[model samples]
Structures are given as structure tokens and as C-alpha cells.
Target: MANRLECVDVGTEYCPCYLAELNECIVCSQLQGKKFCDCNWKGVCVFQEFVWAGYKAKVTRSTVFTRILKKEEINEEVVILTLKVPNKLARDLNEPGAYVFVRGYFSPSFFDTPMSVMWADEIEGIIKIAIQVTGPKTKFIASAKEGEEVYLRGPYWNGMFGQRYIKGMHNSKALVVLRGIAQAPGVIVILKLIQNKNKVIVLLDKGKVQTNFIKDYIKNSDVTLVEADLLSEEGQEVLKQFIKDKKISVIYSGGSDEQHINILEYMDKYESEAYLAVSNNNKICCGEGICGSCEIEIDGQKMRTCKVQVDIRKMLERKMSRG
Candidate 1:
């Protein structure tokens, strides 16, 4: 059987995006140049939206200049940026898996770097993101001074897969494992889980960034915090024990591909039925799915990781096979 694919933006106002015009719509078979409709989507029809818009894609997300409210240098390698945006934008990005493309205002569009929404305050009209200075693009962002304006294009919500579980699961227990700078995105995930009334436990490893930057964010929240080196045998034992004892219903892995694989391995070893969600980890040059840099093959289908709702199990299978 063919793998069922879901586009992150399918039912949103951003539906019938540029992909539809190119006959490459992720969820619509008819829009993919097929003669008949065979989409699994039960919401508004993407093809109908495309036709209603006169065979054109709807308006794409616009780039805007946002003022930097604050910048906190966590360490030599990491910085947290708080930007002032519109209230609506902040609210839209308050959910799990939200991310945006950011660049220094004076830089060219190619300098745009994707960063997850670490924290968002709708009432305050502000959003915070953590940037690790890994390369030129991030270095430019890191150099951005306070009170300066930065270009942002987003409200993108596919930073991670398994968003359904993140948004829908409640009154259950969840375990979030975050390492290095990957801890940035884990904040919104934890917040959303907490908002859903789920019992949340976080296993944090500062990894290469070498600082537990998120400590301040969740300190007041009702969450159990465990700091451990996830790569060590002792940490592995702790993780396995948590799975076996906590009876966690959902697990989110916020780290490198190796960490994701490790968590998946333990889940299987314990015969865990917990739902798994992991960071996208794909090269996302364009958040709009136009660049094709984020494309990956899963179950014989090519999917753009930037917008596709990938199955965590199949994604892990592909990663393990590549090793």
C-alpha cells in the first residue's frame, strides 16, 4: 500500500500553495495531475481551492521586519533572540512545531535561516528563538544587535512531525528528550503538552552547546526535570527505565538523528506503545517547500519534510537503513 501523506498547510489559509500550481501538491492526487480525486483529506478540497483562486496559488507568507526586543547570549556558541512581532503572528506561532525563516535585515534572501519558535507570548506580541552559531547564516543572525530589525517569513508549523499527537493528546504522561540546541523547539512542545493537561517530564542534555539554556523557561512550570548525558550508558538506562516505569503515552525527541534513533530503539526494546514525535532535522533552505532541499524519500514516496506530516516510525526506519 502507498504511504498516506499529509501536508502541514493543507487545511490552513495557506492551502493550495505554490506546490499546487506546479502539479506537485503533497496531499491532493487530482492536483498532482491525476484525473480523479483520491485525497485522504476530509477538510476543504485543495484542488477546489486552487480552481477557486483562478488556477493560481494563494498569497504566500510575506516577509516582514521585526524589531529585536532582546538578545541573550547563552554561551559563546548560542544566543536567544526575542523579537517583537504582531500579536496574531505570535499567537499563530504559540503551538508546537512552529518555526520561521529569519535573516539580518540587510542580508539577501538566501541568508534566511530557519529557527524554531522557542517561546511565544501572544498578549505581549513577542517571540523568542535560540540560535546556535554553526555557520555563516547563523553567525550573521548572531551578530544582529539589539533594537535592530530582522526580516522574518513564517508562521510555518512543520518543524516537527507527529503534530497530531502533540496537539490532541491530553490527560496522559509525556516524555520530552532534548539535547544541545535542539532544546529550543522542545519548549513549545512542552508548553502545548502542559496546556493539554498532560503530565510532562523532560530529560535534558546540554550536548555540544554546553548550557542548559531552557532551565529558566520551565522552572516555574509543573514539569519534572532530569538532566542527563543521553549518550552515556547510565543515561540510556535511565531512559529505558522511564519508558518502562512512567507508562508515558507520548514521547518527543528533540536532538540529532542519532538521539532520535536511540530513543526509538529503547521504545522498541520495552515494547512501548507511546506515540513518538521528532524534530524535522532536514535541510530547510526555504520554509515554503520551493527549494526542494528538504525532500526525503519515505515508503517509495518523495516528501518535502518542511511541509509533510511524516510518520515517525517510517522516518526512523529510513534513517536506520541509511546507516
Candidate 2:
């Protein structure tokens, strides 16, 4: 059997989610219709939570209308939106990998687009998101005025995997690779690493986005920044040398699956033992696991990348093999 997967909502208020009711719980084997408890969860018993909830999922996230406080057009393709939200909600979204489902106020529910939290100011009751206007959903969001309201549903934490490494490492050296619009989420990850006293080095590649929009966010921070084309020979050399020499304990790749696989290959080539974290590139039609849009089969087991934490290396390896 594949190793047990970790559910993002397992111990949160959203515990005993729809998966448990369907005997498809990611953490609790008992809830998976098994006879004995083989779960690795250390928090509240999911099976018991399910039984107590009358075999139903707990109350899920609710949609809230937030007013856009400010909007800055970075380019024709990208815009940064600062939104006014509740202080509690902002605080809840202050962690790395935080994201939310956003849509125009007049748009239908299917127009809801998952957006990464670029920055969250709890004291100010505000959050910023970089919206890349790539499709109809984002274009609609981009058209919203500064004073207009938009629908938001989250405090979602599964935007990236290997979060334990991001939260656990302290006073260590780390590397953050960012490219294109993926650079938005990298801001929060870099801030988190810096807050943990980790010395951070950021490799920035303005992939197809054509502009380094994150420079202003990290300029004043105490991080070593290097701008390069990560797909080029010089960039690959820098990445390889950094892994071979810097003794990096954790590495976060904020880009495509191809970028993650390339980094993994360098780590393997240099025999680096750094923990890897990458953006969840799965097609997430719904932030919740019920959509099945983010589902992928790995090692003969189906996983919802939206909420389940799978091995990052295994996931990238699977993609590499498929290509």
C-alpha cells in the first residue's frame, strides 16, 4: 500500500469532512471502512468525530463578500488586488500556502477561481492577491473596480505541500525558486522562512509573466536575491551550485511541474537531502475535495491534491515519468 496521506483539514474545524462520510478519509483507516484503527493522526479521532456528527461532514467554509481596497495593474496580464477582510480571517490566512476561492460579485459560482494569498496583514484587516488574467474567470475578477465587492471562500492551506518543513526549520539556510505568477505565493513562503530565522536565497525567473513583480515585496527584506532564467544553462549552474554548496535544508519551488521536476533532478544529481515544497498545480475546480477535479492516482491510490498531502518527490517523479 502507498504511505498514508495527510489531510489539510484533518484536525481543523473542518475535520471529518465529506471523505470520512464516504469511507474515503485520508488519515483515519477506521473511517475508511476498516476494522481497526491504523491512523497516524495525533489530534482528535476523525472516526469518533464522524460518529458524533451523525456520520456527516462538519460545516464547511462559507462565502464572504470582501471589498477591494486597492488594485494595481502590474502588466496587461497581471493585477494585484488588496482586499478588506475581517481581522480574524486575515490572521487565519497569514500562513504559508494560504489561498482562497475568489470570483466577481455578479459572476456565477462556477466562476470561482482559486487565488494564492500574496500577503496578509491581520492588524490591518487586509490581504493581497496577484491575479493573472489568464482566462474568463480571472478576466472577470480583473474587471472588478476598487470599491466593488468580490466573493471569497477560504483560509485554505493546501496551496503548497511539505508545509511541515516550511514551519519547522529554524535558523537554517533555505532556497526559494520563483517564476511567473508563481512568484506571488513565494512572497509568503519567503516571509515565513525569514520569520523562522532562516537565511533565505531567492532565485527569481520572470518566466512567461515577462516582469519581476515581486521585487518590491522582497527588496527591503534580508534575503539574497538572484534574478535569472531558470531554464537557461547559467541558471541551472547556479541552482546546482547552490544545492551542492549552500547546505540548504529546505527548498520551495513556486512554478510549474516542469520546474519542480528540474529542481528535483538537480537535488538528485548533487545528492542534496533538502526537503522539497512546491505549488499545487493540479486543476482545482473546487477548493473542496468533493469536486474530484484535483484528484490524481499515485501508486495505485487516488489522492485529492486539494487537501491531501502526498510526497512531493513522488508526485514530481510521476509527472516526469509520464512525460
Question: Per-prediction TM-score, please?
Answer: 0.98, 0.97
Tell me the tens digit of each residue's lDDT in model 1 across 233-282: 99888888887754799999999988889888888888889999999898
Which sections of candidate 1 miss by over 4 Å? none
| Lowest lDDT 10-residue stretch of candidate 1 | 215-224
Instruction: Tally clashing residue pairs in candidate 1.
Output: 0
Predictions in order: lDDT? 0.91, 0.90
Name the lDDT of candidate 2: 0.90
lDDT, residue 288, candidate 1: 79
lDDT by residue for model 2 (170-231), tens: 99999999999999999999999999999899999988889999888876456999999988
How many clashing residue pairs appear in each of the predictions shown? 0, 0
